[model samples]
Target: MPLKLYKKRYEDIIHSDLIDRKKNLKLIQLMMDMESAFSIPMIKNEAWNERNKDVIQFFQQVSNSRRL
Candidate 1:
C-alpha cells in the first residue's frame, strides 16, 4: 500500500486510544518516517552494471597478466 494509506491508518490507530498516544506518538512517527525514508529507490541499476563491468575487466586483466 502507498504511504498515504498507511499514514491514514496509523492516524486512526493512534486516535483510537488503543495505545498510549503521548508516549508512543514519537515512536509511531519515527516508524512512519523510517518507512518513508526506506521506501525510496536507493539502488541504481546503471551504477550496478558499471561496477560489475569494472570488476570483470579487473579480473580479466589479472588473469591475462598471470598467463603472460
Candidate 2:
C-alpha cells in the first residue's frame, strides 16, 4: 500500500474503538516496530546489495574456493 494510505490506516487504528484498549495499544506498538524494522537504513542496505550483486558473488566465489 502507498505510504499515505498506510499512515491513514494507522491513524484509523489509533482512533478506532472496535478492539480493547490494551490490544489496540499492542497493535500500535507492533506497527511502530514494523515501521522501524523496515526503515531507511534497511532499505538502503538491500538496494546497495542488489546493485552490487556481481561484487558479492565474486567475494563468495573467492571464499568458497579458499574453503576447499
- Highest TM-score scorer: 2
Give one digit per residue, the lDDT tens place, for model 1 in 11-54: 56445545454425543454545345544223545554465554
Query: How far in Å is the alpha carbon of 27 misplaced in model 1?
Result: 5.3
Compare the candidates by lDDT and give the number of the best one: 2
The runs of at least 3 residues in candidate 2 whose Cα sits more than 4 Å from the true structure, single-residue gaps closed, are 19-68
Query: How close to the true structure is residue 25 of candidate 2, measured as C-alpha lDDT?
Result: 61
* Lowest lDDT 10-residue stretch of candidate 2: 59-68
Q: How close is candidate 1 to the true structure, as a TM-score?
A: 0.31
Clashes of 1: 0
After superposition, candidate 1 runs with Cα above 4 Å error? 21-37, 40-68
